[model samples]
Target: MTKFFNSAMAALLISSTSIFAQVENDTEKPNSNPPISIETMAGSRGVMYQLIINKKFQSIPLGFFSVTNAAATWEKEMTPDIMTQAHLTYTLFKGLDISSGMQYTPVYGFRSVAGLIYSYVSPQMLIIVNPKVDLADDLAAESLALIEYRPKINDKLNFYSRLQGMYGFIPKSGIHNRSYIMLRAGLGYKEFAFGAASNIDWYGPIKHNENNFGVFVSALLF
Candidate 1:
């Protein structure tokens, strides 16, 4: 076991160095086309795959693990000079998670729903405080909002700072129902990001706030 652990550590170190070097090189280039975006994260005893695809026909998006115990959604993006795509995610995990509006190009404008809009001036800073809304008879989470601040660290390196506040409310719950707040921040080069993510949920299924924090790396699978 010791030998295997040593080998794994060495391999991870080598891979990190390689990625850092490549990112530097890409930053030095004059201009590079925007890469496709697919977010994948692995850590905290679980893994998440958030692929970006959109279609008019209704069908489930498929990927690794090949099971429905996970969260998955597909989005459609088609641009006629200025293109905008939206995704609505409803699942068994967190009830309903609808992402904010984003702009893929500079030709059009950006829109947001629920809580407050982040920012219209900087285009990179967004702050929101959501109010609870009805999802169903038994399904609901205390109104929650998240602020995502993205900054370009370098030509090839981008840093993402995300903070979310959640107040869980189950109108049909029998007992303890707690609120949760999560912070996920990371740095990405090209289409990959690595960093620390933590989640704390109080008074829910376990009656106590569960704590989960760890290193996570996500890749663009699209």
Candidate 2:
């Protein structure tokens, strides 16, 4: 199990490096700007591992609740902006909020796993909800709520915390459905972040393979 997680983490790092290389830097030039961005997220639950790719487009704005349809209105209000996203999840076990599998096991498949995400991004906070349905033998409808907050601390460092949870409506299970909540809190230094991640699931308050406390790292690949 230790070897399995190590291999997964190594793969995540390798992919991150390649993505960082391919992505053109966005330094806020005086000319054209692209709204597309990519982010990398990886974590472990003892032996179970998860790697996620988060892609989002922010240029196309949804003026649903804004006073004006102008894209600049979001910049002024310091509130949420409407945007679309695609989330890809790969995991060794389905215990985390990201996967829809019913039990804890070694089998992990990416066959029919994908999510559609829409987000409202504000200056100090972000909210995202994803809708997903798997139609294969592993059937599930995964609904998720994700939130992030960054508080003012200093010039180079800030306090940050994120709450992400999901419920799996697997009527195929007949009775028990799957659900999990993952919370992470720590300090952010520029583009790099290290935080403590804690998660709970319906399988029990805690599982044997679950790590009570884990260190998680994330980076804006773009």
Candidate 3:
């Protein structure tokens, strides 16, 4: 009777060990499914004010300007004459991006603007290309090219200067060209930034004006 009981106990122990080994093997199996990609949320808001004084020496009027989420899908603002813009972007390579968007401004007399922009950012320089077409009553088109050089100032402050030129073609009118030089200074703390840019518009003939200044403050949130 003792031998029979010992044999039964041995068989029970072997069965339990087999079951444990099978569970371990199942847990160690490699998963063949790929990991899911996650999307990140980022947003920015800026408020700008411009004072324009023309060469005719007229009264200076305050121009309120604002651009919110300038790079995202549903970006819009009201300060710059009640303008709204929608953008879609695709990354072509590292540090380079291409974006296309449509802008509408009711205050500007129901005008639609379609534009393509390319931006390149590096440690020492920044470049932007913007080509736009006006798809409204007046068939007008414009292109702006800008280049900025980054200057290292400090940990919280930085300085840069840019040169931009704009050319416009209007129906029944000849080509119009304008060039501007801008100086920008930025102060950053955490996710908030304050920046000011001074613009000097140089109009080629036709009595173009000059000495226009704009200041802006921006905040970024994650």
Candidate 4:
């Protein structure tokens, strides 16, 4: 299952890049928004990388989006560990969508998921809230939320910051599942951004906690 999961992720990423290239090479432009973005951080405790894709079809009514998140600790610790999650969403309304995807965590392994997402975007801020359920033996409910703010400090530089968190638990047995919170604050120059980042994670019924703090760099990859 692990091998299959890894392979699936590689294929998904590769296909996304291929589609991006094809779109650029062809005269048919889909949307003005960048199709992909990437972020990486190296903290005192570990290193983290994340990729997000918001690809919209010109012919389709709405858009489809995907998110991939991962992190690794310097000491190879499992607490502040590596994880990945991806979701595909179809827009239902202006700021609401139905989404489903898969996620892999150290504690939960890999699980199939289905959910809903609502997003709000403006000139200086972006917000997203997602609620989902795990289609597993335990039957867990999960939620993730994110907020990003970028205000113009000047024409060439903009202030950047983001807050994101996730939590999940079983409804029947009331057993705790997993949770994490992440924060990033930096300065962006057009497609490039750099600054401080932090991650806090909690796992399982015992609610063990882990912390990581460090610097980060991000870019918009078209």
lDDT of each model, Cα atoms only? 0.39, 0.41, 0.38, 0.68
Candidate number of the best TM-score: 4
* True-vs-predicted CA distance for residue 188, candidate 2, Å: 0.8
Model 2: clashing residue pairs?
A: none
RMSD each, Å: 17.1, 16.8, 28.2, 9.7
TM-score of each: 0.44, 0.50, 0.45, 0.78
Global fold similarity of model 3 (TM-score): 0.45
lDDT at residue 115 of model 4 (Cα atoms): 85
Candidate 2 versus truth, CA RMSD in Å, comes to 16.8
> How many steric overlaps are in each model, in order?
6, 0, 0, 0
Ranking of all predicted structures according to TM-score, beginning with the best and ending with the worst: 4, 2, 3, 1
Scored against the true structure, residue 18 in model 1 reaches a CA lDDT of 10
Across residues 81-159, which tens digit of lDDT does each residue of candidate 1 receive?
2222343332222112233332221322333322211111133444433343333444433344445556789887888
Which candidate leads in lDDT?
4
How accurate locally is residue 123 in candidate 1, as Cα lDDT from 0 to 100? Answer: 31
How do the residues 1-222 of candidate 2 rate in per-residue lDDT, one tens digit apiece?
A: 323423443342233211111122333332322132223333342312232333222344111110000011113443321212233333233112242222121122343444444444444555555556665685655555566777658888877787765554554653324455667788777665557776555431132222234666655443
